[model samples]
Target: MHPPGADTVLVRHGDLNTKSNTVKRYMEGLLAENLEAILADRSVPGEVERRWSRPLVHTTEDAVEDATAAAADTFGVVSASPCLTTSTEKDRILEVLAETARARYDGGSFAVDARRADKSLPYDSDDLAREGGAAIWEAVADEFEPEVDLDDPDLTFGVEVREDVAFVYLEKRAGPGGLPLGAQEPVIAMVSGGIDSPVAAYEAMKRGSPIVPVYVDLGPFGGIDHEARAMETVRVLSGYAPNFDMEVYRVPGGETISVLVEEMEEGRMLSMRRFFYRAAEVLAERVDAHGIVTGEAVGQKSSQTVQNLGVTSRATRLPIHRPLLTRDKADIVEQAREIGTFTESTIDAGCNRVAPDRAETNARLEPLLAAEPDDLFERAEEAARNAKLVEP
Candidate 1:
């Protein structure tokens, strides 16, 4: 078990200056509200407020561990810290700093990294570091060896002394830094019971696009296990959004497989791919989405080859956002694990069971169109109409 922590959480933003003022304000609000939801889950009493350029959440010291862990899931937060805060009187600041370092450092090697935001008062940043380091070393020297290694230390105490108050913290818990959820226009994401798609959807959500997940259910080929896995991935993703409103829609795709599987035997997989995009296009219109989101990474598979993506997307002239298009598979998997979807995405009996052995890698658009049925959009529209919303 970990020890109790300090009473406040110091939240730092990601790249906010580049965004427009409206977008920055919107993300700030969403990030704070998401943290508030996490606090409510733990029954922690806290209030989130902007200080300087970042958010500072005030909660009991005992709740810092829980809050820190929870805050790491929120997007737009570069990092968070459970910190001790006090008035910036020279002696008072140094006293609290020494006390915090004493509790955290157990002799070995340590260093004090101090920043002087208020230069008007007393000593500069370097002198403050030495003063704090000496105080902590003296307090902890009896029990363990105290070697002050300025270059690299086993323990580091970071101090930021503002005009009226100072913050002292040991570590910075990292969050997925991006635009917050709901900051961008809504997108209808095509999710699958696979590692890549879930991670792709997560990337879109991380960039502030509220996603309406559209799962293409492969009938008998995938049993209940497939649906369960997709929904579970969505549930895990919901942690990032906290309290955002979204839904998962499962559309029957067996009809599409039957049409392409028989009509275009040579380029059947490409036909299926086209249908998927067409289905998402129709769903996007229904949901009034800006565009469709897919998990396609460039050349991840034969079906995702640059030529193949062009062929597949031709049916849906509407914009298609492929967030993971240039990303490597390993990086996508790592991100899935970070967003809590990796384990669920690895569940049994997925749609990959139906993948063709010699699928087309560089399919041509004209040929794929010739192979597809004229009423392709009609059937795709039907699938979209049949889609029903479900809770994650």
Candidate 2:
């Protein structure tokens, strides 16, 4: 049994268990360090320990909620729960289970879910669950009726018996499950003021890549409002990884847009997208990033059609990762809301002033390739070099 007044939070692993032994150990170490950093950043006083192949956060009773929240928000975590630790003794387990249930469960259909990680225990999972359920029923029966519903229940009391101890918890807070951040190489994320781009960058971050957010400043075409919204969105994203200092790179892009609009009338949007990719490639080289992430979705805009996407993709050699490629606008918006970027993105950034009334949807490769500017790489290099870093 844990000391009196001590609170423990059980942190569940996400996909880290699927890796090889060596990789899993390495990632688990990183996950533990990240969890500590997240708790410290949130001003929650807690100590993290690895036990039973999982991270356990030991905190004070008052800090348990914050500690659990911090753990849940961290990458590589599937869920987090503030649990009560007790001995593996059957009677002690039932006593703690009943006490926890009486404190948390308020007269409703409930279920007892028990798991025995230690097979050495005399009782199996089913026996533990049955005994635990009966204990809880007896404890709460005096006040109100407590019906047991295995299929679906209003309240669920979970019990897990380990080698030397057991854990009793009522709720599991869901986390953004994926590999730990910094697990993959860095990537240059082409972010915009709109909802889609920020969500795209977040998905990349969730997949273990620390992103270098590049905001192309389309001068007269994209107004000050647009730049402000984009910066705010990046700031919102920076909150997710509080331990990492996310630097936003502002690239000047108005000159390139002006040139493309004048040089190609119908294919200007395609050419503009190409310019964005080319600039991202240059920034990628500067940052040693392996890929570029964008918010492009199929048929979302005139420039994002299948053929046009392929044509624009040719502008850079690096892999272009569109996390929202197949996602609908509504889904993207919902994800944006979930990630705390929707409100910042909703701020009225004026419409694209330079977009053609009827932009080319299915652009052919040969013609657009031939019209490509010879100084395109040079311009990209200049933009990348001149990019100002905004610290969040």
TM-score of each: 0.93, 0.95
Worst 10 residues of 2 by lDDT: 1-10
The per-prediction CA RMSD against the true structure, in angstroms, equals: 2.2, 2.2
lDDT top scorer? 2
Name the regions of candidate 2 deviating beyond 4 angstroms.
1-6, 348-351, 370-373
Pairs that collide in candidate 1 are none
User: Cα miss at 224, model 1 (Å)?
Assistant: 1.2
* Candidate 2 per-residue lDDT over residues 259-357, each given as its tens digit: 876776777778777888888998899889999999999999888999999999998999999999999999999988887999989755433566777
lDDT of 2: 0.85
In candidate 1, how many Å is residue 58 off? 1.1
